[model samples]
Target chain A: EPEVTQTPSHQVTQMGQEVILRCVPISNHLYFYWYRQILGQKVEFLVSFYNNEISEKSEIFDDQFSVERPDGSNFTLKIRSTKLEDSAMYFCASNLRQGGNQPQHFGDGTRLSIL
Target chain B: AQTVTQSQPEMSVQEAETVTLSCTYDTSESDYYLFWYKQPPSRQMILVIRQEAYKQQNATENRFSVNFQKAAKSFSLKISDSQLGDAAMYFCAYRRSAGNTGKLIFGQGTTLQVKP
Candidate 1:
């Protein structure tokens, strides 16, 4: 089965540096999403992307966060300035359809560590 | 807004035995989707099973099955003839049916330990 794939399984960056997490969603998927989980916390939604635009975002997705679909298969999330609290496991997911009833497949998350 | 709750923080079962994890949610929307996701040591989020709120019959996938009580707002996962590979953190999630965003709200996970 086809699955979502994320690059740089682990990322380490300075506190004030910028970081970009990349994902390659399933070829046929139309909707993409980003979620994050603190070490011991629940997975929280960050943003959703469709048609080269952001469809929805959570309060956690603030000014520092931005998502781009630079190419057909590549979807990237960039953080302008990293904070210690921003260290977490970032996951990318995609679904074939628009409805929530459609199940979204996930990639093996990228673990972001801020120094 | 919707919220998913996984009551059991941790559970244990023998290799061949059975185990059940409990989940509950609060949502106003009548139509939605409920999902169970497993995150193993590798941190890969895998979809275990799914249940549509509109379906009255329970959803089952091989050794994994769900007891979905829509009216009671409860969704529980049962693993039969558990294997060591089943040991992982299980998460319960909820998603709305009408929204185009397809965002999922996940509950705090339940850690399942399967002894060999």
Candidate 2:
């Protein structure tokens, strides 16, 4: 089955440095999202993208965070400056359509480690 | 704001037995969606099953099923004929039906251990 694919299964970055997490959603999917799970914490929604623009975002998705669909197939999340608390597992998900009943398929996830 | 809670942090079930994982959520919307996702040690979030608020019939997928109570804001997952591979972290999630940004609010998660 077609699936969302994320690059760099694991990443290590120093505090105050920038990091970019990339994802290639299913070809036919139009809606994309980014969520993060801190160790031993709930998975929290960070941002959602559609039509090549941000549709919505959470408080956790502050100015430090940005998402882009540079190419038709590539969606990326960039953190301007990493912090220790930014360490977490980042997930990329996508759906064919935007609706409550539509299930969003998720990628394996990228583990981000900030030192 | 919406919230999902999985009271049981960990549960163990013998092979070939049935196990139920509890999930409760708080949502004001009349119509929404509930989902159960399994994350194995590989850390891949896999959709196990999904239930729509408007659908009274419970949703089931193969050995995995969900009991959804809309009025009570509860959705529980039941796994039958469990196997060793069934062990994983289960997460219950919620999303609004209308004006949805495609963002899912997930529960803390429940760890399941299948014993042989």
Candidate 3:
């Protein structure tokens, strides 16, 4: 089965540096999302992207976060400045339809570590 | 806003036995979706099963099944013939069924241990 794929399985950066996490969603999928999980914490929704725009975002998705669909299959999340608290596992998910009821397929998360 | 709750932080089951994980949610929306996801050591979030709020009958996928109580706002997962491979962190999630928004609200997660 086709699945979402992410690059740079692990990322390490300094506290003030920027980091971009990349994802290649399922080819036919239309909706994409980003979620993060702090170690030993629940997975939290960060943002959702559709039609080349952000559809929804959580309070956790603040000014430092931005998402882009630079190409047909690539969905990238960039953090302008990293903090120790920003270190977590980030997951990329995609669904075939935009409906909330559709099941989303997830990619193995990219573990972000801030020094 | 919707909130999913998984009260159990951890659970263990004997190999080949059965186990059940509990989940509850608070949502005013009449139509919605509930899901169970498994995150193994690899940290890959895998969809285990899902239930639609409109469906009165519970959903079953092979050894995995759900007890969905729409009126009570509860959705629980039951794993039959549990195996060692089933050991993982299980998360319960809720999603609104309307509009173009597809964000998932996930619970804190229950870590399951299958003992041999």
Candidate 4:
């Protein structure tokens, strides 16, 4: 099966610095999403993008967080002025279409360790 | 608001045995979907099985199956003939069927330890 791929499986960034996590969703997928799992915590949704704009976002997705489809294939999440609490495993997911019945495939995830 | 709960923090099964992981959710919307995702040591969330609330019949994939009780808001995953590869952290998730945002609400997760 075609899978979503993420770059820099492990990222270590200093506090107050900007870090970008990148993902290449499945080629034909139309919906893309970002989620993060803190150590020993549940996975939480960050944001969803479709038609080149954000469709929905969670409260955790604050002003410091932003997502963009910089090119045709890459989906990126940029965090400005990272905090220690930002250290978590970030996962990118994609679905073929809009229906929630369609399962979203997830990438291997990028482990962001903020110092 | 929707919340998924995995009460059991951990479970264990012997090789060739069967084990069931429990999950429950609180939601007012009747039309929705439930899922089981497995994340091994590698940390990739892999979809194990899915159940649609509208469907009365439970969904089964190979040795994996789900017991979905829409009225009780319960969805559980059963893994049969468990193997070493089955050892992973299992998460139960929920999603609303109505919206275009297919964001998944995940449970805290249950770690499955399989012993040979």
Residue ranges of candidate 4 with Cα displaced over 4 Å: none
Mind giving the per-residue lDDT tens digits that candidate 1 earns over B46-97? 9999999999989999999999999899999999999999999999999998
How displaced is residue B9 in candidate 2, in Å?
1.1
DockQ of each: 0.83, 0.88, 0.80, 0.84
**Candidate achieving the largest lDDT:** 4
Candidate 3 has a TM-score of: 0.98
Docking level of model 1 = high
Candidate 2 residue-wise lDDT at A70: 95
The per-prediction CA RMSD against the true structure, in angstroms, equals 0.9, 0.8, 0.9, 0.7
Give the Cα error of residue A6 in candidate 1, in Å. Answer: 0.6
- Cα deviation of B105, candidate 1, in Å: 0.6
Off by over 4 Å in 3: none
Which 10-residue span in candidate 2 chain A carries the lowest summed lDDT? A96-105
Tens digits of per-residue lDDT, candidate 1, A47-70, equal 999999999999999999999999
Model 2 off-target regions past 4 Å?
A: none
- lDDT by residue for model 4 over B14-101, one digit each (tens)? 9999999999999999899999999999988999999999999999999999999999999999999999999999999999998649
* lDDT at position B67, candidate 2: 88
Interface RMSD of each: 1.2, 0.9, 1.3, 1.1
Q: Candidate 1, residue B87: CA error in Å?
A: 0.8
> Distance from true position, residue B40, model 2, in Å?
0.7
